[model samples]
Target: MKVLLASPRGFCAGVNMAIDSLEIALKAFGPPLYVYHEIVHNKYVVTHFREKGVEFVDHLEEVPHGATLLFSAHGVSPEVREAARERNLTAIDATCPLVTKVHLEAIKYARQGYTIFLIGHEGHDEVVGTMGEAPEAIVLVETPEDVAGLTVADETKLAYLTQTTLSVDDANRIISRLKERFPQIASPPKDDICYATQNRQEAVALLCSEANLVLVLGSQNSSNSQRLAELARERGVAAHLIDGAGDIEAQWLDGVETVLVTAGASAPEVVVEECLDFLRDHYGAEVEVRTTREEHVSFPLPKELRAVSVE
Candidate 1:
């Protein structure tokens, strides 16, 4: 069996920064560090941090008063920030810059009286946070079909923003439909889908063309990871999204001589290594890494973490 690994997979700049921030926070603050949500949507990452005394909470009220609270990479709304402040919590914002950009755009469009159309899944953490930015102004649309049912106060004052983790092709299709309906709709200065998401999806699409089955190493709730699997399946290739090698089923390998292995942006390379090792040990698979693009993007650690001196 041959295993083709997708390059530009696994951790992106945002995930790297968020993970680093948490580690730095833990090192500086010690045990009982509280994170607003999973720093990144990988089971292994959350589990590792939890073992190291990190507590992931869905609500700000869950955190102890005056405790250090780190926001997840999926940026939170202003209301969350206010809640942290209300409790006197030492809040560290670990939101990915790209997601923050979308939030800012949502706020801007709302202030300008534009009815914002947020292109994303309804319950995604990122989408939830973004929608909270301007709840009254932003409307969630999941697909191109959802675009038709949208009710905006004024067609001329329509603007669109997207979840960073959405499929590039899917977003483009939705954007095309939005344009067809509202020709004068405003858009962000650049595409809202982050470069990392676009790069990883493009790599997976390319890898799927040569491989019969694609194994995506990512948590089920991970939006980008789910998109990767969907993209491959849409291309008529068998794709499975697994958290790690343990989730891999023997049945998935049947009649599959060449398997493409890739990971979501939030997934760590360590998880991917485990999957590769399993494939090597079980199937004697020869691995080849296929590179689609070179990425050197990096975001700096949060200011509070940077202020801490190394011991």
Candidate 2:
């Protein structure tokens, strides 16, 4: 069996920064470091951190006063930040810069008296956070169908923004529908889909052509990872979205000779390695990495973490 691995897979710059921030915080503050959510969506990553005494909380009130709270890379609503402040918590934002870009666009369009249409899943952490920026003026659209029924008080004064980790093809289809319906609708100067997501999906689409089955390594709740699997399946290829090797089933590999392996931006590399190792042991697979694009993006640690300590 041959394994075709996709390039630009696994952790993205934002996930790297968020994970690194947690490690740095742990080093500086010791055990019992609290995180607002799973620093990223990967269960392995969160479980690893939990073993190191990192506490993950869903509600700000669950966090004690005066505790150091780190926001997840998925970003949070302004209300969440305010709640942190209300509890006297020292908050560190690990939200990805790409996600922050969407928030800024929502605010900008809302400030300009334009009703904003946010293209994203309704309940996603990133979508929720971006919508919170201008809740009064923003409307959530999950699919192209949603765009068709969309109505605004001022059609000419409408704008659209998108979540960073959405399916590129789906987002474009939705955007095209929006444009067709409202010829005067405005969009961001640049697309909101992040480079990491675009490149990874493009790579998987390319890899699926030659592979009999595509194994996407990502958490079930991970948007980008789920999109990768969906993209492959859309091409009539057999695809599976597994968190790690343990989830892989022997029956799924029957008649499958070439397998394409890829991971989500928030997924850890170790999970990919484990999956590859499992295939190699079970099927004596030979591996090859198919390059679609090279990535060099890097985000700096939080400013608070960089401050020099007083002697």
Point to the candidate with the largest lDDT: 1
> lDDT tens digits, residues 226-306, model 1?
999999999999999999999999999998899999999989998999999999999999999899999999997777778
Candidate 2's displacement at residue 44, Å, is 0.5
Q: In candidate 2, what residue range of length 10 has the lowest lDDT sum?
A: 302-311
Give the C-alpha miss distance for residue 298 in model 2, angstroms. Answer: 0.5
Expressed as tens digits, the lDDT of each residue in 1-67 for candidate 2 is: 9999899899999999999889888888887889987899999998999999999999887888999
Candidate 2: lDDT of 206? Answer: 77
The local lDDT score (0 to 100) that residue 144 gets in candidate 2 is 91
Error of 1 at 263 (Å): 0.4
Query: TM-scores of the models, in the given order?
Result: 0.98, 0.98
Q: Which regions in candidate 2 have their CA more than 4 angstroms from the true location?
A: 308-311
lDDT of each: 0.93, 0.91
